[model samples]
Target: MTDIHQDPGAATRQEPGATSRRVIQEFWRLRWVAVAVALVGSFVYWPIIDNFRVSLTHQDIFTGETSPAGLENYRRLTEDPVIGLALWNNLAYAVISVLFQVFGAFLLAAIIEGLGSPRARAFWRAVYFIPSAISTTVTGLLFYFIYQPGMGLMDGVLQGLGLGAWSRVWLGDPDTAIYAIIAMSQWQGFGYAALLFSVAIQKIPAELYDAARMDGAGALRQIWSITLPMTREMTGLMVIITVTGAFQVFNEVMVMTGGGPNNASQVLGTWLYEQGFNQNDMGYAAAIGSLIFAVTMACGLAQLWLNARRRVT
Candidate 1:
């Protein structure tokens, strides 16, 4: 009773209709999910578009006047000395953060991994990670007191060691302010990176290390050959995290310095806050936000591409 020969064209026409019907049914079934996704996407991305629009306009926060300024704000950003200093400070912070938070964590993880007893390993891991568990705001406040001019712990320690000449107001001096902040950040953040590295290192097969040891490789040689190679991916990930965190650094800078001591330690986040809220330069602040978003996205994408390429090879 097949009517194939009777009307072959009829089946072809029905096939397209059937396919379209199925697609419509499927979309209807998942309509709520699609709606939720659209809602979330709009909620997340609308602000970004609005921020860009504001950046292109000269919107007075006080008088509520709005005018198109085109690229004037961006041009002013280029000429702004404070912006340049903030950029440089961000770069320095990234470098120092990578050196201490990422690499330092790797070293600590390696040492902990080499411990003979599981109890000792667990103890040290907890000890190192405890600092990271403390609230960052609390850590900043604690360090603020620790860096206080005369009666702080650092000054006391330096004086006790007969190094009084080296202990002059760590946070007060422009030369040492940023570095002191960097050190505090490292102390709080490195342990987290170390814990992650420790987990990655533990996953690496013990047989690899055992094989190296049988070849008369000492601890240093084993680490160089075995440990480092195994944790390469983790190191890459940590570097990306540290760099992004460095660029977006705000809490510590806000709590400790407020970009003070003549704005010597101004970073993009604090600078954005200063311009946007403090100075009522919302349009310019939006521009700075756009720049920070662009740069962070670019760096993240570049890192992901490089990591993927490295994996492919």
Candidate 2:
């Protein structure tokens, strides 16, 4: 009251010190959390950074000697025909996984969600998801037996059904090896995707479906109009996860065909493993690992961007 015409300069002069003190207090409060995050980040990222650095140097696996090779490892990777084959296989695997793992799972989830009884839904979900619970190595070995030439379960079924002519060496043929692995992968993985989609589907409001039904929408129409649109985010997520997993396929190839039949089923993951462990080309393997990391990150980022853009629109 006495200083009704207070100086604007006085308020301005006090503002900076107040802001500085506030910032200092906030930092003090969060100092331990910041320190912990930094420590964890350093621990987690040091190996990745070291791998990138190692990719630039030639390292003797037996003697533990390393020499600067610059981009020679990347050059070798570019020129290698097996690398090209592995890249193509990875692409094909990703496409198949997107189709079956993501889309197929959506269909399965819809079917399960449509069940009249809760017990029936639960039973079918468990049945479908049981295969995913089995170890990947065991699944690979089991499929290896099923795809064995002339005497496996698949061939036996073909014979029993009077389709013996259709039978062949599923995992041993150059033409069918990768496809067989893809099929096995789908059988093992699609259920997990289905379970995820089912959960997402459940989160969608029942009122939406009721409204659609009131509007005389049939089952298929309701699914197309309401279910699919509602699960768009989940579908995008599944695509990202499936594509990433497909590109990193290894355990199945290792256990089923060992990237065999003249490397017909080779994927980047198995190729990297072979280069590092078997061939002892640590630098080349590191380069391949770096490439994989780059590709996977790019794909995931692109997917996220597209989804965000869709939402914004």
Candidate 3:
């Protein structure tokens, strides 16, 4: 009987020196990635772990208020009615912004995708992306004037067109302030989402389109099936980006509304800023910060889980 160990395939597997050399080569080739990952992790964990420790064990490091808060701050998050309202408002704002930005971006990207010449595509892409080039502070300020009651642009045009009844105090009224801000964020953010889709769409093989056309798929049908399905990974990533960005919105609020008209537009980030900077309630504000961090991390992990599942397929 032939010895199993002496078989040709077994000899190939037993090439010890080759395997060792390959491992060594791979280690050297990938050593920089390991170093980079380690360096990045150190910074990430330092702040997260430190912030968690600080939140749980509040010490006035400067003013001597160190007295193991022991979940007091976290407990306050649930019990404080204002905090609850602010958090609910924040959720509402994020949902509104994400819905508008992602949906608008996807629509715009779809309209422009593969339909334009290279020069025309670049032109519209730049046009859409132009607002994102402007600082959020500047854009907020610009829109602040645009929505002014009578002296401003919209009001001016409305007054000119005898559509005075349609115009309202866009920012002054609580009923419309958050929605207006949502529009501003969407306007600035849509370009980013479109650019991401554009980059991903470019990599899709043109042959796929040719195949779809041969099957007599109309542009809309082709988009629903071929374009969107193939770009599901990109869509998931863009949704995560939109959601995280929505949560972090602060600059526009600071410049235009300042969570004003009696906290009508109070999102979590704005509330945290108001507390920490305005009220000087650093401890309480830090708790809000922690919550924001948690929400962002949850969204990130959800995105990761989705991506992993797609890979498994």
Candidate 4:
């Protein structure tokens, strides 16, 4: 019998090589993730940080001079009456959008989904969604012409229906300008919202409805007990999106009323544009942008919290 012995240090020497290979593999794996993080930090997070920095200082466009303004811009935001009007206008947009786009669209979707004929359901969906597919600029311009005081179709129809006394310059009058713009937005937006609600409704199990029916549930009962609860997530999402979009509204107001008739139709987005580009107040504009960011972020955090709560429960 012959005794064979292996060098004990050989195993220890190979362990270091194995460890080195693992370290290299892990480095390679994380290299791609590092690239993504770097890109996002540069494009997304850096801009946000830079915007805050810019908000603290005033920049002159023509003179190309930059000066620190501290909180003066934000102080002006508190005193600026136009800012108050813009906030009110955005609030109206959010409230009306929630009413029509969220609740109303959900009802519309339920009704459309309830129809027996597939063709009818498809037809109605297409009709409603058509307006959403149209360009906002084109839609704004189209509504602008339609809202013209004397020559527009709206006034003409009022006159033809013997309701001429009820007609006002839809886009010209300060009292009605923002509302008119809001109405146009609702008309263009509700269809898309309805389509989303319809998709959510479709995802619901038919067995739930069948079970409800067997339990003596009517259409309204089924909707209340089954549909509403099932689509709660979708409804929450729509509310957040609608409110955010309302605050960010710019194009339609810009194209239709130009925030005119005394800036009655100005929303946060348009107000920011007016401050930065038109009025040449970059610092003030940055502050408005920060406010918008805060609001949208709050909505996003609310959504996250709701989702977490739902999961926990």
State the displacement of the C-alpha of residue 271, model 2, in Å, after optimal TM-score superposition. Answer: 0.6
TM per candidate comes to 0.90, 0.93, 0.84, 0.88
Model 2, 1-313: lDDT tens digits are: 5868878778557654888899999989998799788887788677679889999999889999999999999999889999999989999999999999899999999999989899999999999899999998999889988988887899999999999999988998999999999999999998899999999999988999999899999999988988898899999999999888888889988988889889898999999998999999899999999888888889999999988876512
lDDT of each: 0.88, 0.90, 0.79, 0.90
* lDDT (Cα, 0-100) at 134 in candidate 3: 89
Poorest 10 consecutive residues of model 1 by lDDT? 7-16
Q: How accurate is candidate 1 locally (lDDT)?
A: 0.88
lDDT of 3 by residue, 1-313 (tens): 9865656676457655898898999999988799788887788767777776666655553575755776888887898776776666667766776676666676678777767588888888888888888898889989999998888898999989999898998998988887788788778887878877888778778898899999998988888877787777887877787778777778877788898778887788888888777775666777888998988889889988987787513
lDDT tens digits, residues 1-313, model 4? 8989888888567654788899999998998799899999999999999988888999887898889999988888899899889989998999999999999999999999999999999999999999999988999999988888899989999999999998998988999999999999999999999999999999998999999999999999988888888888888889889988988888889988889888878888899998999988898999998888887788778876886676412
Give the top-scoring candidate (TM-score): 2
> What TM-score does model 1 achieve against the real structure?
0.90
Model 4 bad stretches (over 4 Å): 1-28, 307-313
Q: Which ten residues in a row have the lowest lDDT in candidate 2?
A: 7-16
Evaluated against the true structure, the overall lDDT of model 4 is 0.90
The list of candidate 3 runs beyond 4 A from truth reads 1-38, 57-65, 310-313
Clashing pairs counted in every model: 0, 0, 0, 0
**Superposition TM-score, candidate 4 onto the true structure:** 0.88
TM-score of 2: 0.93
**Candidate 4: residue 309 lDDT (0-100):** 73
